[model samples]
Target: MSSTRTTETNGAEPTYKRRRTQRSPSPQYKLDDDDTYEPYISVAQRKQAKLAKLTSWGAGSDKDKANKLKEEEEERQDEEREEERRKERARKERTLLMEAQEVHERKAVEDSKKTETEKAEEHDAEILAAIASRRKLASDLELAQGVQYTEPVKTSWRPPRFIRERTSEQHRRLREKYHIIVEGDDIPPPIENFTDMKVPEPLIKFLKSKRITKPTPIQLQGIPTAFAGRDMIGIAFTGSGKTLAFCLPLVMVALEEESKLPFVRGEGPVGVVLCPSRELATQTYENVLQWTASIAKEGKYPQLNTLLCIGGISMNDQSHVMNKGLHIVVATPGRLIDMLEKKRFTFDHCKYLCMDEADRMIDLGFEDDVRNIMSFFKHQRQTLLFSATMPRKIQDFAQLSLVKPILVNVGRAGAANLDVLQVVEYVKQEAKMVYLLECLQKTPPPVIIFSENKNEVDDIQEYLLLKGVEAVAIHGSKTQEERQYAIKSFKSGAKDVMVASSVASKGLDFNDIQHVIIFSMPKEIEDYVHQIGRTGRSGKTGIATTFVNMNTPEQTLLDLKYLLMEAGQKVPPFLTSIEDPRAAQGGSLTGCPVCGGLGHGISNCPKLEDTQRRQMASHRVSDDRGGY
Candidate 1:
């Protein structure tokens, strides 16, 4: 049995061995079938086989795996670095673009400014050349005519012998005749009529043509002082012929100076008359044209030229007129300063500086501009300051600008005309319109209603129109055309009532205004006087009614009370008895001594407190540091 089992085992073993040989043949196998024999291979052979397989797959031995991992890491790092480089490149590109744009805008603005500066400089140069050529032509014309031109020598002024010889009785009579009060040395006596004022015959004929036989008080005294080349402050009411007073003397001196020296183009004006408003400037210019016409017609002052320099008009036209040469310039301060800045005109040759409504000009914030203009004039030039009221500050300005100025007060300073009957009606703010309507019904046409602001004026005007009352409104906000039309309509009796703001409070001449209704009184007493002065002008009696209310400031109420008492007007008991809240709080009624503003004392002044606190803190720090 063993022999037979052995024989069978040997036979099965041969078959099994043959099968195994057939399945796993040799170490070197086909590359395509290597994976088929991979499990049956030895551990070392399997590793070698794996290495060969990995080599084929681009990952062979451990060193090869490390090299592959290193290559992958290096590739990943390179890719990340490339992405960072791309981002950095994009950021640099954006930065460069932004910097380029900013540089471009700055360059554009710089170029524009440079161009404007160049154009202005070129225009100035052209003007200078034209002036030089005109001067050369004048010199040549004089040489051709065998005439020697010489600058007139300035002589010290002296009072006329006739004025010096006047007796005390004559002076007293002159003062009583015109209600004149003169202060300072060498005050000339007032004249009775235009004929006695020593006015030239031609000007007298011009005056007669206009049917102005009698001289107003301001003209009586102001004309003589101006003719004598003395600085004068003429205080008179509105519509008191103040324009003619300054105009006659200005024309006479301009003509006399022209006769001595030929009119030189671009030499600036010989006389400068500054008005506070464009309308006032226009009115003064019209008077100048009228006064200079007779002389111009007689060919005595053929080169006489009067120019009006005002805003809201063509600057080119004004410059053209100035280029032609101006003997007298009637201008507003703003336009005059603008022209002066452009070098279009100069004040070097200005012999007379006349400021009509001088106080109003200062109140309108032209004080600095006036000072700047005066700086351009020589000390010998005469200054004539005319206003209805002069405040303390305005007097100080006069002292600095004028040389021994003669203060001529025709009437009481800041006093309304006694001829105008003043009445005060105590009414609430809400009831103002109703009371106004009732007053208007009783009063006559040609009435002026003064409001505190533009909106109030507009509201009053609209209300009146709705009530079938023909009314117009004038204010600083109104256009020039609108203001002129409103004034014209009122003057022509087309509009029965004219509502206005403070713009019409000063220097406006309304001779036919029968009543001035103060719908709202102003804060300043001087303004109140001027508003009432508008009526009762030209020797005509008128009425003024004011509405008082709680909204009115305590200081304004007190001032109005004093003004009414001084003018002999009836003051209501409420106004006289109202206690000032500021005074009760132990505060000063006067303005701040440091900043000159109301409602606060110098101790509480913002400018003073801040400066004092900063100085105190600095001193404390210095003491703590042992005076370092």
Candidate 2:
């Protein structure tokens, strides 16, 4: 055997000699005696040779490098496989999350649908109950017919004798306030300068189109005083053109200033009018546009960016408009205060201030906001205050807000329009429904019934509808859309009777209302006046019949007196006889010597009482004192 061997050479190849394996090993490194010669010796030598070969191969040929490269390639494949698994798991999680979200959204939509269905069911039940409640009455059937019931033709819109009462002081005040001493016997119209009336031609034309060419005494006199740059307080009964009287001059002033400025782009609104209620504010805005449409067309007025800032509307939408700047902003006190606090609008440039229904602002507890608004105006701006009645509170407000305002009394405060008849029906509170039905039978169609509470209005509306009457109810609780729909239906003759809360009684002109029935006596005499005023509008002859229960004797008496005064009639002596034991009375106290009630004297009875004063005062102390 040889370590190296050789083979025979061929024609094209060469052969090499090999070491002989049969040769014996050196004696220092001998194999076992029985062992033949071996190519590689001990394990140590094999390992050393292996390492050496590896080292040499690494240093020269790249075959060992190829093996390492192949190992790395296999490891990379394993890592790629792990990444694919991770990505699959992630995809599964994402799919699950999306499916879960979809399920949640579907559940939300189903819940909303269920809520709407439930609401519809409730509304349907209410309607059915209302219909069932009125089936017993024939009047209900008449109401269902939507037929107009015409009131008996009255020779005059006059009050019955019992309700026609007056005090000496009230008479004197009325005479002095309305019939002032004349310098001469001719008794010229109160207007000092008729020619000074500066109503714009456009306004005159507009009024004529509305068939209102002749100004009410208030309009004729108040317009000039206001136009003459005098702060004014115009006190008049409802239906006395109070809105137009204030609106004509204010719009003209805006137009006059607008003309002086170049027709080029400029800021809007030189005047800001405030009304206490949303409907009033909206009505005022409409009247303003109707009066100023000609000027608006002539480009003599700012585009009248009229903004209505009222509740029940999106504040965001309001903010968007306010940020754009308003030429005229008609708003309720609360919403206006809200926007003002947010710095959404400024009144720095407001030049003219007209508080239409100035008394309403006070009654509505908006005095603070009104004062707040006053602080924002320029010191020299003109101010005008208009009210259906001039109570002491309003007089005080005038003192605070107006600077030397010229007093224009169209009719005495608390004076009723002669066109409105005041009628009080004495009945028990529980019998109101029956009495109302009876009155509706005889009282002709198209009447308004007022209730103090929204629930009462709802009850009454339901009752009327059941009795076959086409009536609609409006109150604070009704959605804005519902209230508007009711109002429009009444206006369009789609509905005959409207059962409403206090909102309907204020600043709305419902001329077609032939009669108004107060289903119950109002809480305050002022409210009673406004309630009845709805019928006798625009100098149109209308009647108001109030239902008074025995429990409300004091209110009935006071309301009767107030109503008479508003109608431009004298209060009869009986209304003032509070000391008369036979006179109507209430509130478990000594009779009013003036009104025949223990709570107040007839002569001293304010149209509306102080809220706290009407409450039982220190009853415990009085009881301890053994006072009845």
lDDT tens digits, residues 1-628, model 2? Answer: 2354455556555555555556587667555764767575896787577768877766655776788677669878999999999998988878777979999999888777765435444444464343223121112323355432222111111222332354545434543654432121111123322233544565556667778867676765566556666667777888888987777666666556555662222354467788877778877877776665755666544544566778877767645445543566677878877877776666666667788777766542565577666555543567777887666445544654455556777555656667876765567788889888877865667888898888899999999899899999998889977988998888888898999998888878875788888877765666777788898788787767776655676645665654454455655555654343223322223223211222333333443244325333545567779965
Global fold similarity of model 1 (TM-score): 0.65
**Tens digit of lDDT per residue, candidate 1, span 28-51?**
757875665543568578657766
**Per-residue error at 557 for model 2, in Å?**
2.2
lDDT of 1: 0.73
- Model 2, residue 388: distance off in Å is 1.3
Candidate 2: residue 185 Cα off by (Å):
23
Q: What is each predicted model's overall lDDT from 0 to 1?
A: 0.73, 0.64
Ten-residue segment with the worst summed lDDT in candidate 2?
149-158
* Best candidate (score: lDDT): 1
TM-score of each: 0.65, 0.61
TM-score leader: 1
Which whole-number lDDT from 0 to 100 does residue 468 have in model 1?
95
